[model samples]
Target: MAAAARASARARPLAHPNPGVAALLVKDGCVIARGWTQEGGRPHAEAVALAGLGDGGAEGATLYVTLEPCAHQSARGPACTDLVIAAGPARVVIGQLDPDPRTAGEGAERIRRAGIAVTVLDDANARASLSGYFTRAEFSRPHVTLKLAMSLDGCIAMADGSSQWITGEAARAHVHAQRARHDAILVGGATWRADKPRLDVRLDGLEARSPVRVLLSRGVAPDGVRVINRPSQIGDLEGVQYLYVEGGAVAAASFLAEDLVDELHIYRAPILIGEGRRGLADIGLTNLADAHGRWRASEQRQLGSDTFSAYLRSR
Candidate 1:
């Protein structure tokens, strides 16, 4: 399941409307075939893995899939559950159940009816890899990730608002890579006016994967930029399963205040600006106790000279 989850990461926002699933066929404790969801959501992971089998095939092999094989057939592709049944796997281990109403539990039921054993597991890695799909399936909006770069003293810039590079090149490259994984990237109106950032992926060979540019403001956006009046209107963003918010103070605070941010990424630099611009504005918090249990740290690492920390909402 962990290997399948790692494979799923390669097809993330690219799969959009479909869950970025992965499948592994193992026989005699050796992985024989592996596959992940292809681009544009065609040829699901199970089908791809099944196709990769050689002479031995899937008979008597155990299939590990990150999500339940889809039972409902689509005009674009065949039902994955049917394919798995035909492959004659001894057992299917599913990391998570399908959330789509069309095949919520139907896929598992069909597989079991075919005389194949099915085991469902609550896997953390698989769930994290499918966060975008789960968020979109349950809520209408995308999974929101708010990213901020600050100094050791928790300031975003000097008091004059002349902020340039806070973290080193490695962190900036990492941010661009993250931008490529999201369907859209947004910045507040104030930040847009101040920095005029490109807000696009700059890494070599990934320039084409730059996310849709979004402006969080009521005012008119420049040519080719999408606009949302407020953070609550994130649901209106069509086809966006993942939304990355790169910010100034006001916009970051707005999303945090509304409790809309599902994940938080913090990049901390080594320097300190004593009396400088803050990383966030008022988030409408009355009691400090309310903030204690809302976020759980998931990862922390050093990127060049800066420290990067990631947290997930504990809901």
Candidate 2:
């Protein structure tokens, strides 16, 4: 299941309008076929895996899938549940159930009725891989990730307002990778005007993956940038499943205050800058206790001279 979940990354963000999914055909403790959702979401993971086999490759094999096979038929293609039924896998292990109302639980029921064994697990990794799809389905908005790069003393800039290169090259590269996974990247009006950042992915082969540039402001947006007056306006960004918020203090605080951020990515450098600009302004929290259970650390890693930590909203 974990391997199937990891395989979903190959199709994520590229499979917008459809949940990125992966499937593996295993027999006698060996994988016979592997496939992920194709670009533009055609042919689904199950179909792709089944098609990869020479002939009857799925017969008596156990199929592991990150999400349940979609049962609804579409003009684009046949129903995935129908494809799986025809492939005739002996057993099906689903990491997570489909959240879409049209297919929810029905896909598994259809497969089970065909005399196939079905196992559905409440897998965290599978759910995490589909976070953007799940968020949009449940909340009518993108999954928000707020990113902040600061110093040991939690400062984002020097006393003179010079904030260039807070972290090393590796950390910057890491940030770019994160940007590529999101559908759009946003910054506060102050940061947009002060830094004039291009906000585009610079990685060698990933230039095309650069997300849409967005500015958080009431004023007119620049030539190519999109604008949103308030964080809630993120819901209006049609087709944007994931939003990466790179911010100035005010913007970060605004999103945090409204509890709009779903994930936090922090990069801390080795140096300290006392009496400098803080990483974030007040987030409307009067009591520290209220903040204690709001976030839970999910990842911590070292990148060059900086350390990166990720936290997920506890709720």
Candidate 3:
């Protein structure tokens, strides 16, 4: 189920309006086939996996799926629940329940009605794969990751405001990789004017993966970037599943103030710029204890001379 969920994330921004799903069919203690949701969200994960079976793949195999196979019929495609029933899997292990009102628990219910055993796993990692969809459904905004490249002491730049190369080459490359996956990259007007950042992905063969560039500013719009005057307008960005907020402190803080940030990606170089701008502006926490359970780190690692970590906001 974990592997199936991981595979689902590959669909990303293209899978807008639908959660990318993945499916794996196993029998005799071996995987018969595995597949993920395709581009444009067609040929759903279950269909792909079912088609991959050479012979006798689903008769008694167990199906592991990232999401409950959709139960509601749609003109878009046949209901996944129908397909799974036809395939006759012996059992199904689901990573998470589909949140769609039309299909929520019906997929599993239908499978059980067919005498196929069903199990739902308690897995946080699997749930994270569809965070974008959940964020949009629950918050009416894209899943936002506030990314900061700062000094070990929490400074983003020198007091003079030059912030080039806070993290090393490896960390920069990783950031580029993130850009390739997200649907949009956003920054404040100050960062835009000072950096002239070509928020495009530069990785080989993925140059086209450059996300839509957005500027969070009330000032003059920069050439070639979509401009939103206020943070609240972020919810109006159509089809943006994942929004990467690359920042100057003010823009980063604005999202935090609105409690719109879903996650945090911090890259800390092993250096200090004690007098520089901080990574974020004050978020108006009246008491230190007020911020205790807002976020929890989910990942930490080393990137050359930089320490990188990711934090997801608690529900």
Candidate 4:
């Protein structure tokens, strides 16, 4: 179970919209097959593992899957539950149950009905690995994370939009790490025009994991830039598991208005920019009370002269 869970973690930031799931078939202390959720939602984890099985490899084998095989059928393929049953694995160990209304516990139930011994291990590691996927499946929305770098007074840039190097090297490096963990990074057209950021992860020894660069422009974005006009555009990204909203005020306001932000990462520098650009765009919350209980702080840390805090949406 631990090995399977670790493998699943590797697929994070890569699989989005689709659950980052990994599966392994082990029998008699030897590994038989291994697979993870592939791109574009085709060849699900179960199917990939089963494909590795040659000559009916599932017979008398134990299948370890990260999440309960999906029970619902879609245009992409048949229900994963049916595939597992037909493959005929002797026993199935699931990390967590699917929470989507169409599946919920149905996938596991189907496997049991097929006479395959099934076990659901709700361990902390497994649960954490699938957190983003389960959040989306249960809530019908993307797992959102807001990334902001500001001065002590909460200014993001200068009054004339000269916002560069607000944080130190350490803080900037940390931001790249955050990018590496997400499937996509989004910014508004205003920011794109002003900064022209590469928006790709750049830590040494780490593969250049570039989150799909997205421009939140209502119309055509700048030349050579990837753009999405509406909130609905997110659904088309397919397997984006984690979305990072890097903002200029207007773009942040748009997402907030849509109630699309799921998490927040705020980095505060030691200096203040009293007459600089505002920290955040107007989100149009009725009042501070209206914002109450919508989010919970998840983490807080200090790096050099900067402070980083993370918040998860309460809902």
Top model number, TM-score: 1
Model 1, 183: alpha-carbon shift in Å?
A: 0.8
The order of the candidates by lDDT, greatest first, is: 1, 2, 3, 4
- Tell me the TM-score of model 4: 0.74
Q: Give the TM-score (vs. native) of candidate 1.
A: 0.98
Report lDDT (CA) for all predictions: 0.93, 0.92, 0.87, 0.83
Per-residue lDDT value at 18 in model 4: 77
RMSD in angstroms between candidate 4 and the native structure over all alpha carbons: 4.4
lDDT tens string, model 2, 53-155? 8767788999999899999989999998999888889999998898899999999999999999999997998999889888988889999999999999999
Regions more than 4 Å wrong, model 4: 1-7, 23-64, 70-95, 99-106, 114-128, 131-141, 205-208, 230-233, 236-239
lDDT of 4 by residue, 178-258 (tens): 888888888888887788888888899664677778888876766655688876567555566687888988888788788
Q: Estimate each model's TM-score.
A: 0.98, 0.97, 0.94, 0.74
**Candidate 1 deviates by what RMSD?**
1.0
Residue 149, model 4: Cα distance from true site in angstroms: 1.0
Clash pairs (backbone) in predicted model 2: none
Candidate 1 overall lDDT versus native: 0.93
- Per-residue error for 263 in candidate 4, Å, reads 0.7
Runs in model 3 with CA error above 4 Å?
Answer: 220-224
